[model samples]
Target: MPSKSPAQAALEKADKKANSSSGWFSSSSSKYEEAGDLYQQAANLFKMEKLFREAGDAHAREAECREKCQESNEAAQAWWNAAKAYKRGHPDLAIQALSQTITHLTKAGRFRQAADREKEIGQIYLQELNDLRKACESYERAGEWYAQEDAQATANACFKDAADLHADLEEYPQAIARYEQVADGSLSSALTKYSVKEYWLRACLCALAMGDPITAKRNLSKYSSLDTTFSSTREAKFINIITDAIEAGDMETLTAAVYEYDQVMKLDNWKTNILLKIKKGIQEEPTII
Candidate 1:
């Protein structure tokens, strides 16, 4: 074979080098496009599958492309749906969705818009469902959100409702503590009166049921002082006999009185007080007529 001229060889070498470079560039660009297409396909499939979590992951990969294509609305909608799906059986997810919604709306300067969603979640946990603890937690979250928005009364009311439910469960210490909070805070008179009265009555009933006469008497005195009509004619009559027997210092009479009262009252307190009084009297006097 005849050797080529220097210029011809050099031109040929340059052409070959250009072609190789072009080929490499084309291959790299094709691979990048393929990756982009795969990501889009995965996102579409995730949407169809209602797999929000996977969709979110896939969307994160193409976030720049999504922003350029005005696909943020679609991403937002997907996140919202996924949050809802988790909410039915997952309280934590519901809370996350609510938080995200608040964040997004607040960034957009539409705080009130986010508030509606938050209130919906609060009502679901508080009223429609009977999960009082969860409901109260939700209310507290709402109250914080409302307070941030300067809605004081709404926040206070939420706290009040939470406290009332705690009281209903007979958590006396917690109930009393919450009641004190309301009394000290800017709570309304109507609510204050209702809660105080209800808590007092419940405490009294609980002390009575627990067979604590001292506590019962204290509660009774408070109740009677508050409402003069708070009278149990039957109980008073039954107790009168034991009081008389104690004052008379007669064991036989006390025993007979308690037995008679038991026949009429048939309650532990009446029997207990009668026996206690009779034992005390008998101990004080060794001789009985």
Candidate 2:
């Protein structure tokens, strides 16, 4: 028989404490703190043993116990620790732990840290889970915090990530709305002058992809309102071609115009693929002019 490892012994001790406390009926915060300490010890042992999933669970329990005792800082710390543990073995569990961390941080009025955690959560959803919608939601939350802080550059970046994810999901109206929001934020400060025109044009592309000439026209007008000479740019010309193709239900012409635009300035593979998907969607379900 193999000797019991240190981690196994610690787990047993922690389990004993938890089981014994079940009926102790102690309302003292110290009692909960003691149990939380035991759980944390067990979690550390589990991590040393490479039992990361169990470590995460143990740490989460520790966090819960701390939270029940009104230990906000300890609860947040435990949650973050749990997230780190779970990320090694279970991405979904990591995300859940991060969510708890964000909740605790926000409750503690740590808005900047919460926002940073939200962005990390978004990246995990996007890259690890391949869940674009949830990623978009996380990014939107982060953007709200950054906006509240008047960090417009970071806020617009988060919005762009959300918009890109929405576009990836083929939620054109939502993507356009996010892009428009980015453009609006950029126009709020002269610092983002370089990006405002491109953002508006992206919004126009999304509107064209929606096969909504009215929406496309509205975006063009909105751009003019933002910057009087925006229509003179090559991006605006390409957007005009796209809108015209959309209005005429001419996907071939749309493709040709996109090709021409790419010839002059190479388009990203992602944007090109999104355009293809949009064209296919329109061809499958043609809306009236």
By lDDT, who's the top model here?
Answer: 2
The parts of candidate 2 lying over 4 Å away from their true place are 18-28, 248-253, 281-289
lDDT of 2 at 125: 92
Error of 1 at 54 (Å): 15
Q: Model 1 over residues 1-289: C-alpha lDDT tens digits? A: 9996443343344334323433544654343333334444565566566665554444343332333344444334434544555554555565565555555556666544565566656666665456767666666666566667777666656666655555455454554455444433442454444344433433443343333445545555655565444444444433344444544555577578657756875645523642454365445665555
User: Model 2 clash pairs?
Assistant: none
Instruction: Say what the RMSD of model 1 is.
Output: 17.8
**Candidate achieving the largest TM-score:** 2
Clashes of 2: 0
Model 2, residue 26: what's the lDDT?
68
Clashes of each: 0, 0
lDDT of 2 at 34: 78
